[model samples]
Target: MPPRCQNILLLGGSGLIGRYVAEDLRLRGFTVTAIARRYVASQRTSADDIEMPIMTMTADQLTHLMLDRKIQMVINCLGVLQDGPGMDTMAVHRDFTAKLLAAINAAAQPIQFVHISIPSAADSDHTAFSKTKRDAERLIAEAGIGSTILRPGFVIAPAAYGGSAVVRALAALPVADLPSDLASRQFQPVAVDDIAGTIAWLCEHGDHTHHVWDLMQPEPVTLGAVVDCYRTFYGTDRSTRIRLPGFLLDLGAKLGDATARLGWTPPVRSTAIAELRRGVTGDPAPWIAATGIVPQTLAQMVNRRSATIQDKWFARLFLLKPVIFVSLVLFWIASGFIALFISYDAAAGILSAHHFPTALVGPITVGTSLMDMATGALIALRRTSSIGLIWGILASLGYMFGAAVLTPDLWIEPLGALVKTGPAIILMLAALMTLDNR
Candidate 1:
């Protein structure tokens, strides 16, 4: 093989690790292609973006894609922390990988396969995540292809996402609720850049067909220390750690497992907790000896990616955003219910006093009341939130206009009932501005 692989294919290029890997390889002037089920904005090559389900694709289709693309090196950067409704870790990590390896074996040209495997995968008895990863590693080894299995520890980048996002969130909490057993658990968190650079170097200079490198910094830092690093970076108050019993921690994980069913990937899932409890650390000799790259320490990594004012605010407001979202939903629903049931007769009488006929008063009251409830319902749903917010704003404006024209006295009423619409409108607008389309 040449010093620089001519054509490289990156699977799971949409993911954080894969994105970094692709960029690193591209910067080194290698011809790189990235393929994933979802569209990744970073993938620039038109030929690389194959937006199709990997698991569903047949062996022949995959083999054709690899050979047709003239991919000499294949990097598998796929893994899932938690399994949910649409995400099956076993299927992707194990089954899909098996299919890919089989395709590689059948291909006319030999492809150098790079597999991302978890540390301690061989020893891990719990969690399907670890087991499936180990199973994938076995398949890759048995496929008789040139393969490099990278067992990296906690991979961190300049900006955190996915599992790292969860770590930052936990670290930013005002008070840390940790399992008592976890304080001493240490991890050799590796910089993502190191992982990417090392992989690139391996593609160029590697001599062995099969190798397992532990990609991480040699220094072992405790789990609590990792959290503290983030907390310090964000300038959050030094967290007062409260340790919970093992049983309580287990219960929380169980709850997280249940919540995953609702399409929410809670950070504290049973598998995640199990992995954390086990800790993530690996030997650094193999990677350093092969790649000739010294890994950055946690402090070094943190210094390079110092948190800005916006980053700090974002970290603090992570949970606050959802809280505010839910609060707005409740506010609209409660306001609608109160207006519909309690203020009906009073509103009807007010309309009548303004010469809205008595018979029409009841009909108009029901109609407006139903509209209020409808707006609330719409706002409460993720799909129709923007529409609901607009409706709410319009409804509030309409109510205020009607009051000003018909019952002007209510604007200056002692309770300021009519005046409340102004604040309600402002709140609705605020909620609309923060609407998450993604």
Candidate 2:
């Protein structure tokens, strides 16, 4: 009906779904302009890949950008699972959607809006995440724009992120223990490629009906069965598994909430757990009939390709991230605490014995101890963890060099305190390397 849509604009281009969809669309001969808040080193900046914070932009600005780029289609992949530092559920899922709809209406040329949303459940309003999502869907339906809202079930992508990463980590664990109730809950998964394929189909056909379609496998599967599929892929299906108590899962959710406030987006947050309890389900018959896409089963998705070493490493390290951060936080804070209070005299004595000025000893000891404590605090927060790790590495290096020059004998001390600094520095470097959550 409408002229074949072209010149697309994709939001959240650096995300798990956004990245794959952007690449897929480009390969299919669409002029796609991908936008993200930030890009990794591997993704070079160019006209196609533009880094901009869409949340801060107004509708007028978005309209102007769309007009300037001559965008005929807008695919919004931007979404947040919970509220955290700079991550508001309402702002992202509802307010932004409203602005985007207004922008679409304002544009001189018509634009096809493709929004990626979660599958609806009876208890969709149980959490802020789902509530705002439903709010957005309603806004889109009422916007009077040619739009297609796709509600995808648990997405099984080659690249793991958010909930999928947690699933992989659980499968990779030596023992697979899950709460009995949660283990049996329904979890209908859709392949990421299917979502991409659907979008490509829309792009090719120029169909922008105001229709909300559920994209997932027809058959249902349990949460435990989904994990078992990953376990089978990882060749660990025979591992021992036990049913964990409900309280442990509750505790984990609480911990996840606590970490979220600190700027970390853990997959096990309270909102995430709430949504998980509700489980992922949807009727894909309408979508399949409309798009003529035969969705892949869980086995087909998992066994599409053999697991790689990198995939295994990521799965194993997914859970270890929190452990690494916690250890670093305690390590730095304890070191500072001992130096400042528990062993203040001993800390000052080290410098004094090396002929450090009497007047400078206390100030130096107090200042460095405070610096150590500050570094620990920074590392504890996700927003500043990278900066904190850099500072820690620098401080550790300074300590090593200063000790080598003034307290060389400390290197060979019975405690080997200086020798231990090397490993700590190495650990900090490792944390820095794995800092990015996207």
- Candidate number achieving the greatest lDDT relative to the actual structure: 2
1-438 per-residue lDDT for model 2 (tens digits)? 433777899999999999989988887778899999998867644468988988999999999999999999999999998887889989999999999999999996779999999896645568888899998999999988889999999999888888899999999887757788888989899999999999988887746569889999999999989998999999888888776788888898899989888978788878888888888999999999988999999999999889999999999998898889999999999999999999999999989999999999999999999999999999998878999999999999999999888889998999888999999998898888888876
For model 2 the TM-score comes to 0.95
Q: Residues 129-170, candidate 1, lDDT per residue (tens digit)?
A: 888888888888787778899988888886556557667776
Looking at model 2, report the run of 10 residues with the lowest lDDT sum.
39-48
TM-score of each: 0.81, 0.95
lDDT of model 1 at position 370: 77
Check candidate 1 and list the clashing pairs: none
Clashing pairs in 2: none
Q: Which stretches of candidate 1 lie over 4 Å from their true place?
A: 1-3, 40-50, 173-179, 237-268, 332-438
